[model samples]
Target: MAKRPEVVPDILDWYAESARDLPWRAADRTPWGVLVSEFMLQQTPVSRVLRPWSAWLERWPAPAALAAEPAGEAIRAWGRLGYPRRALRLHAAAVAITERHGGEVPDDHEALLALPGVGAYTAAAVASFAFGRRHVVLDTNVRRVLGRVIGATAYPPNHQTATERDLAEQLVPADPARAARWAAASMELGAIVCTARNPACGRCPVADRCAWLAAGRPDNAPPRRGQSYAGTDRQCRGALLAVLRDADEPVVGERLDLAWPAAVQRERALAGLLADGLVVRVGERYALP
Candidate 1:
């Protein structure tokens, strides 16, 4: 508390020795690759994104390449990564990068933020990871690690606060490259060791410095619950989208009905997809958009 937390160096050392060999982190990885990985990684696990990301970059290695294609192609290629909207947004972002930034993922945080579908968190992530500029890259994993280590909270607030932002900013190293490394290191620590449930405390590099561990690791203020999937509208949506994704061409509305059992739920999900621009009505058939 008096000085920088003693755990910082330990976490960095662990990261250097233990980081996953992700394609996005490869020395040869392009800025476009990093941007694409970031977009695919939101809410979805790394395991699911690996094949898709590889094939995608292989197909469209640069912003200009993806921007040249129809947005619907991006959706079809997305292939059940859960939120297909991200694919559309990434396509839009690619278009912006191609037209406005001349086919380059801009290094400036503000410029990245200006791209379609790029939010504050994404802007900071792209700037720090891709460009190696100092910024507080607070993703969900980073927030959980910080909450436990510094605030002794089992979980962070549902919404990030001004106080949380100030703490995160103070924790970032002043040197751009060092700050970027720390940002990544802390996030990795959260994802692999300080997990949401059944954290491997014995494996954590900063177990000794963690305020939550020292405080007996009390329960969350409310409670933590795993997300539900069965019978949800999200499940219905995925089912409907999967049918469209696999089709070689636009299929009749009747063909889509075969994908899901509940007619009313299927119709609602279909309407929602149309609204989100993830699906399109072509004459009497539905198709990916």
Candidate 2:
């Protein structure tokens, strides 16, 4: 196995040359841009986010800009990103940032967490990636990559554990700038090379030190389940929302009826959206909240 000290540097050096030219990671990117990217990226692919993210930043360059618009406008701009609730939450977060932090995205991690819809991961990510602060930004990619390199796991747990948190904290570099870079580097490595399936072991910088590789890349974990979207309530929800999202004004019941084929599933999905505050009743018409 490769020495622990060398593995970190190897990954870092590899990232220096290989990191994707994401807009959020650009030198000119603002804290607000990073925060917006974090919101748009939740469970969504980078490819799906790129255009929407650019449009969002263009329309609302800062927290104050988004906060100035109706919450529904955010939902309209969200496009087909799947989870429409995030649009409402992001609008709320923008209001909080404007009211609480004077239009600037908070630099302090705890301050970031205090924002509406801001969680531990989002807070740490904004702090580290935007402000260049030390933090364990352990998103799925970071967790997966480190699990293989350090813990020899074929896959990390479905949910992060206290043990994983402790291990990640210890793995973070002590220097603030380097730690921030490490956070982005590790996540990038996992995304491009050390993917969840079909990891390119030959291209991995730390392959020599990967405990999972040294152990012959055993699939010791139980078989993972894949999520089904077709014919699911989630698919119905997306369909119904698409009608409202595209309409110039609130849509009537008949409009939503054409969105989803099944009467029962359509009603159930629309009800769920209304309950989740992604949709609202405007008289008899339904519209984004």
Candidate 3:
């Protein structure tokens, strides 16, 4: 196994050479930009987020800009980002930031955590990447990297745990700036090389030190079940949302019914959407809130 001191520097060197040129990682990117990217990235691929992120930054620019608009505008601008509810939450977060933080994305980790949709991962990412603060920053990528390199596991637990959080905190460097860099580097390495499936161990910078590789990379965990979208309520919801997003006014109940053929599933989907506050009833019609 590689020396503890060498792991972070090796990952940082690898990241310096191979990191993707995402806009949010640019030298000039703002705290607001990082916040927006974090929200857009939840469960969405980087490739799919690129255009929407660019357009969103161009249109909104800052928290105050998005705060000025109606929640529906944010939903409409979300385009086809899948989880449209995030758009609503992001808009609400912007309003909170504007009202409470003087329109600036707060630099404090706790303050960032208090934002509407901001969670532990987002808060740590924004604090480290945007403000150059020392933090654990354990996103899926970071967690996967740590799992193989340090924990000798094929995969991390299905959910984050107190033990995982403590380990991550210990792995973070003492120097604030370097810890921030390590956060980004480790995450980048996991995303591109130490991937969940078909990990490119040959290309990994810390392959020599990887405990999982040293142990012959055993597959102790069962295969994760792939989620199906077709004919599911999620698919039904997406279809119903697409129609409302495209319409300039509240859509009639019958118009929404045309989005899905199965009466039971359609009603269930609409009910779920309404329950989730993604859609609202407007007299006899429905609209995005």
Q: lDDT of each prediction vs. the true structure?
A: 0.89, 0.89, 0.90
lDDT of 1 by residue, 184-233 (tens): 99999999999998999999998988888999999787634658989988
lDDT of 2 by residue, 1-289 (tens): 1225557788899999999999999989999999999999998889999999999999999899999998889999999887888899999999998898888888999999998778999999999999999988999998888788987887888889888888788778899999999999999998999998899999999898889999999886663577886899988998888888898999899988887879998999889999988899999999988
**Decoy 2 TM-score against native:** 0.95
What are the per-residue Cα lDDT tens digits for candidate 3 across 1-289? 2236568888889988999999999989999999999999998889999999999999999999999998989999999997998999999999999999999999999999999888999999999999999988999988888888887888887889887788778778999999998999988898889998999999999899989999999886753566887899999999999999999999998998788989999999999999988899999999988
Clashing pairs in 3: 2-209
Q: Give the candidates in order of lDDT, highest first.
A: 3, 1, 2
Q: What TM-score would every model get versus the actual structure?
A: 0.95, 0.95, 0.95
Q: Name the lDDT value of residue 180 in candidate 1.
A: 94
Positional deviation of residue 52's Cα in model 3 after best superposition, in angstroms: 0.3
Candidate 1, pairs of clashing residues: none
After superposition, candidate 2 runs with Cα above 4 Å error: 1-5
The model with the greater lDDT, 1 or 3, is: 3
**Best candidate (score: lDDT):** 3
Per-residue lDDT value at 171 in model 1: 83
Q: How well does candidate 1 match the true structure in TM-score terms?
A: 0.95
Measured with C-alpha atoms, the lDDT of residue 260 in candidate 2 is 81
